[model samples]
Target: MDFFLMVISGAFSFYWVFLFTTHTYLLLILSQLTYTDQIIPFELSTHPKHCLSVGTRSRQVRVPRVLAIEGPGEANARAERTWRGRVPSERQVNARSLPQRDSLHRYEFTHPQMGTVFRLVMYAESETQAQAAATQAFAAVDSLNASMSDYLPDSELSRLCNQSGNGQSVEVSEDLWQILKLSDRFSRQSGGAFDATVGPLTRLWRRARNLKEMPDSARIEEARQMVGFQNISFKKGQKIELKKTGMRLDLGGIAQGYAADRCLKILRQNGIRRALADAGGDIALGDAPPGETGWTIEIPASQSKEVTSSHLLTSLRLANCGITTSGATFRYLEAGGKRYSHIVDPRTGWGMTHRVLVTVQAPDATTADAWATAISVLGESGWKKLKRKHRRLKAWLTETPITAH
Candidate 1:
């Protein structure tokens, strides 16, 4: 039952719509201004929900609704022109309604992918610095996506996928190699639940999902034969190879976390002290802002529409820690009145039967990301196994009621 819930949570969709606000003088002259040190008090309303107070920051800025950059290397067209168009009107309303502060400045940026929106919040020492940091963060996200996404022909993942697996080792970047090594360790520790070598199985299930049908049992068994951590061979000096030609690899499960980690690195390197990277909920936090407890996360309940609780975790303050949640709420196929999740159990060569949501917290995004998937596959037994392997890692498993809530 615990395992079932972990699986459901691991794949559930948690959507966030962030509003950023900036103050203009037109509202100040109108005698309807809320001002304090140049910062504005704005109310952000999200679709299907609303957040109140949520607290105030130095400045509030929203990303102009723009066309979303689609799959790798697409033209820089407007992603959402309507949203962009609405920004001015919204800005005016916020300017008229909200109070302003002198010293506080807020800037926001949004990117759409992974079935949800990604938001970044920046509060800088100066308005110029705030805007500049927000802009840099947005560009960094685009660059990070360009580097990590499957869209780029020259992406590390794309190159790794095309490499021959004739038992001859291929050299990869330290970053990619670290991800692979961490994946391997998780694979062994989770009893093969988190194998990166299950790329073949993932591909198969992806096709099944598109078809909205269960895969052929015989074919699934055949794919299972090729899916195992044992099939991958790794060596020193960042070399790796698959033993079988038909075997494949997919980092979709962990790439977001890795990218978040990389983004965090970039932010720190650029001397930005306090920042949060929300790569579709594979969040990485840098130093916490003064007087802030930590990043506030909404823990969604089994029902997709509601959040049962909220957690303000200081765990992000610990260097190198990342959080990943996996569940079966999104990306599933239903056939003959039965639903199969997209997360394939490599050991079984089939989609997971359990409905579980698993949230794992670990030292890095990569580890947390992979472990969340792996431990979900392991179910309760996998949970026990992971406890032995990673004493520092913590997990929370939530399951759908056999009887509806």
Candidate 2:
């Protein structure tokens, strides 16, 4: 499990504001005077891209691509990668370690996107700018989530899934199209370990988790028939189609990381040079935080209560890269003395049975998030082969060390 505690202003109000600098709608903060002026204020600039005309007036803003989605814990049942830090539990955020009245102010906000708490941390000279920047960054993630979330029945990805088994190519947004292409590329590269078409299997295991039992073999097989990344058809002209009916696309593994990357972009564009956008476990760091050299993180070997600090598998200082850790610690199904991870292997129509915790660091959050799960599915041997093939990809896997040969 990952823990992040961000200190932010307590004053806030709830309202949905849709603002845009590009074709995608950005989730803007709505308020007055102090909050509103700093965030999405109406102003006129020569840059048409940044200004939206309203009642013969234009508001100044930056032009950039955005995605949209509802707040967290408000939608259908989706695993949400379980990395996005939710409302920080008492143990997650340590208040004593934090600095007081620092030169660089830090701001945090919780978005209901991905069904988890997305904590955006930004360092700026003033509290107003930090709050504004964090708001925009989270809005960027909300936009991406709106487009990629399978939980939303009306989402772009869900609509695409509805067009499945039609044997006809349907046009998709550039963002959705790009994500599907990456999904296909990684799915092939990982040899079915990282599959976007594992929606059926994920749902099955989710049920098993609730029941604390294993799924029936027959139902598993039925879902398996609809689970295959190879069944997706990506043709020319940015069109895609599911090869079969009953096939669902779940971006649980990669979407959050991609959203994190986009959030980083939004932060940089807003002149925020140092920040950390932690989309659950998928963390994208933009430079170091203020005076710090790099962001510090710990990678543990297992979730076992007995595992101590000395048992740490890896500790990292990360900057300008994406870090993701995948394990069965938080969510799993246990039955017949066997514990199953929520990460379903699409090829086998089952969950990851091995007690493996895999962490990967890559140039981007998307790759790191997807590869972490893929490496976990591959286990030790697959990781060795993959490491040899992708030299830049860093991974650490700790498997069942209880039993000796």
The lDDT values for all models are 0.59, 0.69
Give the runs in model 1 whose Cα sits over 4 Å from its true position: 1-104, 113-116, 127-154, 300-320, 399-405
RMSD of 2: 23.1
* TM-score of predicted structure 1: 0.65
Task: Count backbone overlaps in model 1.
Answer: 48
Listed per candidate, the RMSD to the true structure in angstroms reads 21.7, 23.1
**Would you estimate the TM-scores of all the predictions?**
0.65, 0.70
Give a tens-digit lDDT track for model 1, residues 102-164: 232334555665434555554445656655665665566565555455546687666666764
lDDT by residue (13-116, candidate 2, tens digit) is 11112223322322222212223222222223333221111011223345321111122212111212112322222222232222122355455555667966
Give candidate 1's whole-model lDDT: 0.59
